[model samples]
Target: MLSLRTRFTALLIISVVLVLVIAAVITAWLLRKPPEVMYDRVLAEKAEFALLLLRADPLAAQTLHITIQEKPAKDRIDQDRTDNILAEGRRQGYTADVVVLKSFNPHRWDIAIRLDDGRWAYLDFPDPAPFPYLPLAAYLALVAIGMTGIATYVSNVMMRPLRILDETIAKIRPDGIIHELPETGPMEVRTTAKTINRLATRLNAAVSSRMRMIAAAGHDMRTPMTRMRLRAEFVVDGDDRQSWLKDLDELDHIADSAIRLVREEISPAAQEQVSLDAVLRSVAEEISETDLPVEQGAIKPVLVKGAPFALKRALRNLVVNAATHGLGARVSLSRYGGEAVLTIMDSGPGIPQDLLGRVFEPFFRVDQARRQIVPGAGLGLAISQEIIESHGGTITIVNRREGGLLQTVRLPLCKPEQD
Candidate 1:
């Protein structure tokens, strides 16, 4: 699983790529239009002027013909003069076409001259400078590169704040520690950063306050619990004493449950690399010593970085719960992909479908025939979930089709298989 910062960076890079692609597309569209269109328009207007001059001074036309042929009419047009004509055309937003033909028939020329007055005028000119493909292609390529660079720069700039936000959020611990996000970037981005930081602060304060209250309550109740136990021991009658002792034991159980709940909620980070197989074997052995029909699978050593004690406690809770409520308990451990999975199957009646999600909540128990049969404060699954989650893992319970409850715990593997 990638960290939030890495994921955000990847998304930003993809967005940059997308923006660059769009910019490249728009640049290509703008660059693809023929460069010759402007040149042709300029030439056409010059040809029309030349023809009009010829009509005005017919004798001058012969002199101009000698000069025009020696220095082609296209060549006779000055560079500055052509530029001025194009600039003027742009100012007026007009488009013209110029075609020059060499060694043309006088009759066809006359027809073209007559047509010029009628709007079908075809001024044929000699092939102008070889198609300007090299310069046009170079210009378009430069434009594409510039556009792509700008797009990439803007994308990087836009992504910087988000990257910082992601990094800040990733630093937040599950125990609800808040890390402030940087308040920078565009107006909208700055607003988002402030909102996220405020949310984190609120959540942290809420979780810390709740955990402190639970811890304080659990701590305060222990002295009263001890005093009550001491008082219960002094009951006179044998049956009455036993009943009072049982009540005291129940009170002790309640105190233990309360303390365990608070501890799980405010657990400190104590993760380390541990062998999953060893932990499972130890749990199975302890359970088997109690005469429970607990079976073990062909175990492989799977290394994972996590709170080993918490994991063991979680697994033990599952096994004990199963043994107390189900016909038998069977535990299996295996590696799948980059994760270590420990599945504990029991022959107990499965939980109701609707209650499966609620089973993880503290003190939530399913109402069923076996509800009273099991001795629990309903915190077993909740504790198990807390332990697993603290180790960056998950515990899920599902009904087996073969008629039982199946609890699967998945922990990320620390050691990957070498190919």
Candidate 2:
């Protein structure tokens, strides 16, 4: 599909060309007759008039500047132009032989009319140059070029508002933050910017309200959870006490995860250059102490700009997720282009293809059975995604063809000065 600016410019050029073509055709039709025909006819009429006056009074005709000749003038006229003059003279009822002669001056023409007494009456008259089609074509081409330039300028001016709108909208962050647009330019542009600003204000308010509600609910749940745990400790039967404590512990984990997820959404932590290889190695070593199989491979020093603690937490969640769910994890870090690329591979069963898209959704799981096998609320992936995206990074999960799952994380590398 063509853009609006391109379409507008093309339409304008086409319209101008069509108008020019039509005007040219009309002008050509109106001037179809050659100027020589009219010039010859006028000369022929003057020669005839001079002959009539010469027969009546020779001296008076001589005073009229009529040059009487015994034979035709030596100056030659073009055959086609002579024929046209003859035809025109015949149309005016003069069947006598008529001859048109060229003059020494290009702007004058002489004509000879055979007199009744076998003499020739010669007369000279002004002539005009023929109609110019070549110059007209050149003029039309110049006009077309000028019109094309004007069309391009007008199209750019008209589409400026839309271009500005697109660029401003692209700057909007995924965290529901809206940057106000400058309400300048034409009236239409100003009105559009005002409307977008109003919509953004409402959207920001709604997102803030929701985040606050979730954070408040998570914080409020901790008081009751502490009370329930204290009550669970006093249960008589060992099995019942254990069951109650386990349920309370799960509820506590859920609240903590919920609060942390909300905090990840709202946190604007300061960022600095951090070594990704060190973070990966530390996570691997810490997980290894817990008897979780996490092997480091191809660890390369890569510096990226982000909060060190947040980056560590996100990486740890991914590593722990793979180790716990996918049996064991193999991690690698390297610099690819201007980005730090990290890969986590595991040997356990991969997620179903149908449920892969929902992995980033909060509290979403492949199946309810995993909820029993895995602990805490299913917000690890969601929180990690928020953290990664906040730091201008990306994370993706895909089922490996051989077996298990592959988790890939890419973060833009910092400048050499930051390292």
Candidate 3:
């Protein structure tokens, strides 16, 4: 499909060309030649004048471009035209026979009249012809080129406002925040920019409100959670007490994870060059100490610009999620193109295809029954995604063909000076 600007330009050029063609047709009609009767009348008058000159003085008439000849030229004669001219001349009261001689060029013809001295008088008057092909074609081509340039310029000028709007919208950050646009340009453009700025203001307010609410809710829950923990310690039955403590622990984990997720979204961390390979090794060793099935594989030196603690936390969440849910996780770090790629592969049954998209949603569990066994609030992946994205990185999870889940995280590699 043609873009709006291209279509607009084409439409304008086509309309202009159509108008030019119609005007040209009307102009040609108005400036066209006189009818054949008028032409014949005029030719007869000129022929009679030439005959009079030839009869008066043949030598003087030849000097005046009226030649007296004993015989007509050998060029082919147009018999019909010659008869018509002779008839017209007789009708004008001239007692003379005239012949129309055809010239070698198709566009030209001459007239011959019988004079009183028995000599033929030749009058050379070429017929009017249309404009030549090459010059006309060149003129039309120049007109087309000029029209195209003018159309393109007008299209770009008209579409400038929309282009500005599109570019401003594209610059929106991953956190759903867009900066205010400069309210400048034409009236319509200024109005549009002003409206967008107001919208961005409201959007930022909404986002801030939501983050504050989450943080407040998480903080408020900790109080009740602590009271519940204190009360659960007094339960007489051992199994009942253990279950209560476990439930309370889960609630505590949920509140802490919620607070952390909000923090990751709201806070902008200072970036510094961090060795991603070293971080991966540390996270693997730490998880291994807890007896989690985390095996460190190929680790290459890759430097990325991000907060050291935040990057480590994001990586740890991913590694833990894989090892806990997918049986064992094989962690590796490598440089691919301009990015540092950290991949975690596991061996357990992969997530169902139907539920893959929902994995990134907070507190979304593939199997709710595994809540007691896995010991998570199901916000691990969500937190990891938020943190990675905040650092201008991406994290993706997919089911492996060989039976397991694969988690891949990519961050832009830092330049040499940053190292």
Candidate 4:
């Protein structure tokens, strides 16, 4: 199937062709009628010939042995007669008008005369003859050919800017870094390229600043957390000490999660192709050894260009999240079309429809009241989504009809040559 842009371009080309055809048709219609002056000249020439023949020898007029018949005016002349006269005229090398009159009222006889000879001679007089529809048809064909050539050239030239725009947009990274585009082409295209470059630069700077601030805050919180842990250890009551320890642990988790989010935001460029099936199988095996009730299915080696560590971390997060929230989690890996799919399904209660969209948001646990029970900062899905998107893929959640929640990760497959 063609993309929207390609279909639209094709429509444009077709429209141009249609317009050319319509214009050609209109031109042919306008040139349909023959010149009236040519007919009058033919009639005058025929009358003059009769008078000349009479003056040469009045008796010869009666001996001429030619018949003058009365008939209705035809829309077109008889092809056979026209051809014969035209041939005779050409052989005689004489330009004469052969007019076929429908009737000579009782006064004079009407006649048909053939005029000049060659292709151009047909243009001299408009009686339908020798290649009747040829001139108009030829003219239309020529116009169509010229118009098609012009339209094709113009369409190609006009599409170059759009192609450049598509390529430039494709190269933009989610990290928000902007690269300068080639400032070439029409004025409008150049202006658009410049504007996009400026916007990308601003976005890059803003995201960088945010990531730095988050990282710095996480770094700054470590000392206070350490100090709090120390003070809690000094508490006399065991329960109080345990409470303080739990609080410190929560704080540490928060700091770590924040740092991880920041690092993911500024993730380094992916360099190698990683086999996703192998990564999933490894995660499944590790979980199984721990007796987590996780099962692996139909694992196949599917390679994709990405940061291997990040991808592994993302897959691990999904598997762990499923096992933690829903018991008897099952991990499955497969390939469909040109994409690699990793699905994690759990037998636990599925998420509410309204919260499905928000599940991937950082720190947005579904059961706020039972946040502690879930044992997470609510950044697992968020991180996983980021990782998949960075690798030019998608992560989605679907509620199973039978029961439970399904986490689906789709990654574009890397070509063998690319690997």
TM-score of each: 0.65, 0.84, 0.84, 0.70
Candidate 2, lDDT over the whole model: 0.84
Give the alpha carbon lDDT tens digit for every residue of 249-291 in model 4: 8878888888887787786655697888888888888877877
TM-score of 1: 0.65
The candidate maximizing lDDT is: 3
Per-model lDDT: 0.69, 0.84, 0.84, 0.71
> Which segments of candidate 1 are over 4 A away from where they belong?
1-58, 66-172, 237-243, 368-372, 417-419
Segments in model 3 whose C-alpha atoms lie over 4 Å from true places? 1-3, 10-65, 73-96, 102-107, 416-419
Per-residue lDDT of model 1, residues 75-137, tens digit only: 433355345445565555544322333334432221122223333233344433444557656
Judge candidate 2 at residue 416 and give its lDDT. 45
lDDT of 3: 0.84
Report the C-alpha lDDT of model 3 over 127-218, residue by residue, as the tens digit: 76664546655676788789989999988888877877788888877667888888877787788888889988999999989989989998
Point out where model 2 deviates above 4 Å: 33-70, 73-84, 101-110, 115-134, 416-419
Candidate numbers, best TM-score first, in rank order: 3, 2, 4, 1
lDDT tens readout by residue for model 2, 1-419? 99988999999999999999999999887876556566667766765666667767868756877676786645575556678877887788755567767667877776677777787777777665556799889999999999999999988888888877787788877576888888998887888789889988998889889989988998999999899889988999999999898888888887888888888888867999888889899999999999999988899888899999988889998999999999999999887778889999999889999999999998887778876667768888998999998899999999999899999999998964332
Could you tell me the lDDT of residue 124 within candidate 4?
Answer: 25
Poorest 10 consecutive residues by lDDT, candidate 4: 115-124
